[model samples]
Target: MASTIRVGVVGCGFYAQNHLNSWHELRREGADLTAVCDVDPAKAEAAGGNFGVPHYTDAAKMLDAEKLDVVDIVTRHETHRPLAELAIGKGVAAIVQKPFATTWDDCVAIVDAADKAGIWLAVHENFRFQTPMRHVKRVIDSGAIGRPTWARINFRTGYDIYKTQPYFYNEERLAIADVGIHVIDLARFFLGEVAHISCETQRRNPKVRAEETATMMLRHESDAVSVVECTYGARKLPDPFPETLLEIEGETGAIVVGIGLRMSVTSNGQVSEESIGSPLRSWTSEPWHASQEGAFNACQHFLDCLKRGVPADTSGEDNLKTFALVDAAYKAAEEKRAVEPENWRRKA
Candidate 1:
């Protein structure tokens, strides 16, 4: 109920830097970034200095002492559930990064906790908020792509993630669990809930313990089928082979988004393409901070929802479907059979 929301950010890892930058942007606009936390004191201190805020090595200490209105978690995929539960338990709203949790049970627990506590809990699935993608969604909703029957989402980036974050090579955190999850979420964003899925994954780079590439086929309840491809091992090419592309086909027309960092739509025999500037490109690069602009936009939305007492666009409940699809795709690939999205269960 304060004039400005107070925020605390946890985890000072690679992506957390972007969160800090985002929070700083909010601070300039009257929000208060009271504190920051990370397991590594040095990282936390560094982020705090960068954002001109207090630093803590313990998230609980920060949450208890700072009177935070919202807690942003940009930690590893596995840590989301616990961090989110802690935030909700403290009566603070939460915004978490993608791959919500490693398991469905953990995700459900987070959702349940937030619901029981009556606090806003959002998954920072920023790709859905990208300008080009938002435009694509508008076009789809406008019936420009009438009743989309098929689509393909590709994240064939040549970005050398391993070189930047060697931990990504760990088998437990493969490209499928990291990068592919984004495309899976994107597919669900454009289409609807997937009823069934079939997937195939491979580790093209033997050096990495996790799969470097994966392909998945999804069947939506609407009978729409689409292919999604993900790769961390995509070779760098002069023509930007490393890109995110989405091609959607409907009853009347088709649309493609992120075509050369922009959006293009064709409806009723008319075609139009325009460049929607990259949200990430506006940020000044500090090590481990790439897309502060995008992160800021996402964080702002979360804060705005908390202030307005409105449901988040990417709430934890909505993210369960995306998490379910990721789990189903892995299972389908492992078992060499189709996996029903609704049937995905977390391991005990």
Candidate 2:
């Protein structure tokens, strides 16, 4: 194994810039960002110029030309399967951004391809890596919250997200598929695997083409229950646009995370207050630091995992659990019944 990992990043759009910045920052940590690619020439050129790396307009071309150990697929969900398959065919490890793909079948296809080829694959599921969420998980792991029984995970905001990604306005599946997926993953992170899920969807924004809000209830395999909520149509003061807030109650204690990244914990009749927030980075800004820092942390995790020859925390197979909840939530809303999430049956 090489001491330095060579990386090629596809999709240099709005969010991929964070991935670029992160990889560039990790050069000191043994990441060699050797190449970048985007269908748009301008995006490719800009990213290349910014990061001082070769850029290509075609992902296949970039993969063929670069001596890359990994390819980061930061493209749209619809592009994930093909990009991942391309990387896997070339024997390069892949890290895809979430929704994973447009549907469960597509997500599974990509995972299947990776598995058959024995290529390392992971989804850039960053929410759980955010500072506040990490803090909450640490507290839970320390047994301060003592087996979480009930919880609510929410990411609601009225901020115009369409400003950066205008395509969000026309997605056939918006809320749960876009932002809610992260919150649902958080619910599973705090509790455990879901036994079933029921959901309600709302198209509160009259101008939007799809449901802009979703409220999902998950019954964990452990019998614990969680209410997962997300929306882009919220009208509120000081909206936590990019923040996830939740309340987790266990047998012995509870953890409540509120606005401003403030967390309150009650363990064994004792209470404590904590401000758990991500530190702003040179390439990160306020209101989005948590998300930006999370992207960085997630990339770092992928690099470390690749170096150690270990499956990522959010490996492709593992992310299917999170993506399954997404598919089930949409189905449960449409069918007006609880739906069991479809699990991946690995090929033997």
The candidate scoring highest on lDDT is: 2
| Tens-digit lDDT track of model 1 for 190-292 | 8987889999998888888878889999998899999999887777563333346888999989987663666777898898988765544445453222234
For candidate 2, report its TM-score: 0.98
Name the 10 consecutive residues with the lowest summed lDDT in model 1.
284-293
lDDT values, one for every candidate: 0.79, 0.92
Global Cα lDDT for candidate 2? 0.92
Off by over 4 Å in 1: 28-30, 239-242, 279-282, 285-292, 343-348
